[model samples]
Target: MSFIRQNSKLVDEFWEKGIVESCPIYDMHGHMGEHYAIYFAAPNADEMVTLMRRANVAKLCFSHHFSLWATPHVGQAPALEAARKYPDILRFYCSINPHYPDQIKQDLAKVGEWIPYCVGLKFLPDYHKIPVSDPAYKPALDFAEALHLPILIHTWNGSPYDGPAVLRDVVPHYPHVTFMCAHCFNNNWTAAGELAKDYPNVYIELTSVPGTRGAIEKMVSICGSEKILYGTDMPWFDEHQGIGGVLAADISDDDIHNILHRNAEKILAPFL
Candidate 1:
């Protein structure tokens, strides 16, 4: 038997049954609603919850595509309704678009109304065409810091907006807020590892990282398991694919456990 199958019950259980009951997944990054540019197989709440059940996912924290792609008013409604309807399986991040300063202020003012369901804030700086460190994000960052909420930022390897360099400027300022670097600064593994090592409140999220062989193992080695989070970017990628990638990585079962759910649990404790 392989070392993983021998030492990790989760591996055997997942291999045989396709889901591990003992270690249910907590997908920290996800999206609801169809994208204007691309098609998604499971965009609606019902279909997503069904997939979550099949994958033994305990909870999924998501932002609506409309919120990111369309106006916040048009996008936040579906996310709110979905979380309201499926409280146990879903939580949402309030998407912030820096372009609409008035809307940003309006939304942040009403944040309390979305409480319990809106666990944190989501920033798509690359798409929004603004650097995360810009003053435009100040209100959202301030609110997140005050509430001690996690902020999921869509980071890429070389984007001027939400890349590692931009993150370096912003993460240090908000020491109280948890910054989940979605996609782990894609392809920039060294910088991602360094960010997690340097900032106690910063976490590297595994959205697109798993697709790169040896990335997860390298991250664990550099920053340890506690600073890494498991996120599928679901509807865009399947949960099983992400889970399989982590399971196949040459890391301890304990490391797998931390990436899959334990670390996420700790991040969500204050909100949920």
Candidate 2:
């Protein structure tokens, strides 16, 4: 066998299989339904949905800066609108910037009204500037628990200023909150896998880690595919590239099912 076949065997297989390559994979973590700054630009919402539809993305988790980290409060209402317009393609998640004046509660209320439209909640602690475990926003936590909505959050790794808050503290406090830690706690992939091993509610996304060596091996070992989710982090990253990296991991067919799609379906199926 050639080196390319040996290393990217799974990648090739998945590509050949196309959308049917894995279980009903829903992108559990992604952000697009926002006004883009020069620094960050992605295909507009329609284009995004189109891409997702082509990729057979059954569900999408989106956050809006208006209600999230933006000033003057932009409600994720537009995100919900997109979800409504493309019910099969989107699952809106209300966002909270605890730093914003009354945003914590306000976003929660918007989430409540988003009923019949959206599915869960998203937090950008690195960009929003909120302590993950802060009791100040217990309302949001409580709502997630009550609504049985999973909370997906961004975490830091090598990037010095990605997500300022540590997810470790928050996971312990909200045991019932199904938390999807983005970046797989880059600096803490092992820890993330341990959390998944330890807690049923905790899950991890393979957004960039597979691009590295150690993280991929550690993830396969610790999380064992079932608790892992596949997402590219999109525009900032590449879906096919991320998928290629994951397929390159030393894992099995069953493992591929969980990482690429099964786990995501399990997590978001309730809302979908």
Candidate 3:
């Protein structure tokens, strides 16, 4: 208890001395639009912007909640509007419905028009209940690869829909498309680490992932911080948890900078 309390104080001091300001922090995974749950902050772009600004976030990459919950077109509106309003600090991802082949085609056709404005595509096979290897996903994946847009895939190890094992098959095939695995494959950091270790194009986003002692360190050791990105799954999860996890990790300042922002700059290079 004493050690835990003492470490907590040091973490507070780390931010008090302005250590987080050393580099621009970019939130690589977030959501915009209303979530019916009362526990979440009201879904509005202005509120989202305010939350990021308070956290010292220089930029945020997010998708619309509607897209993940309902359909692609319905969700893209809010996300696109927010990106247009705050082009400097906000960029969005286009979602596709694998069950609807025409929707996927329409979404991909319009994706080219959102370039520089839309940074990537967000795939939540877990929500859609589809496999990453589905035939419908290939066209969109191909389009993203051709344009060099990063593809953020929600991965939860052991799940039938999308998980590390699913990623293992899909990632290798799309070598040109940067696969940002959300949640570090969730509770399966070992598998996530191995995936990143093996694939140069594979990246990891630390959102709802466990921030236990030596977890971040192990990821850094395996991936070298070049492929690790900081994300807050915001409004649903607190940004401080993600930010403080990396800040308080037992790594060098350079590694901290890379995870906080440098790596995102590289990941989003095509859009920027």
How would you encode candidate 3's per-residue C-alpha lDDT over 1-272 as one tens digit per residue? 32212445444544664334556778899887777765666467788777777667888899888876777447467778889999988899887778777776777788878877788899988878988988868888888788877988888889887887788888877788889999888878888888988999999988876356677888888778887888888767767667777766787777777888899988878787
- TM-scores of all candidate predictions against the true structure: 0.96, 0.85, 0.90
The 10-residue segment with the lowest total lDDT in model 1: 1-10
Give the per-residue lDDT of model 2 (tens digit) for 1-272: 53322654555655765455445456666666444563444544687776666566666666654556563445666667677887776777777666654766666776766765677777776675556666655678788888778887776764332332355555677766888878887767777788778778888877767668667668779867788887765545555566667666677767877787788877776665
Best by TM-score: 1
Per-model lDDT: 0.88, 0.67, 0.79
If both were scored by TM-score, which would come out higher, candidate 2 or candidate 3?
A: 3
Candidate 1 lDDT, 28-126, residue by residue in tens: 999988887788889899999999899999889999988777764584787889999999989999899899877778777777888878889999999
Scanning candidate 3 in windows of ten residues, the lowest lDDT window is 1-10
Q: In model 3, state the lDDT of residue 124.
A: 87
Where model 2 places Cα greater than 4 Å from the true spot, the runs are 1-10, 33-41, 157-166
> What is candidate 2's CA lDDT for residue 28?
67
RMSDs, each prediction? Answer: 1.6, 3.2, 2.9
Q: Kindly report which residue pairs in candidate 1 clash with one another.
A: none
Candidates 1 and 2, the one with greater TM-score: 1
Ranking by lDDT: 1, 3, 2
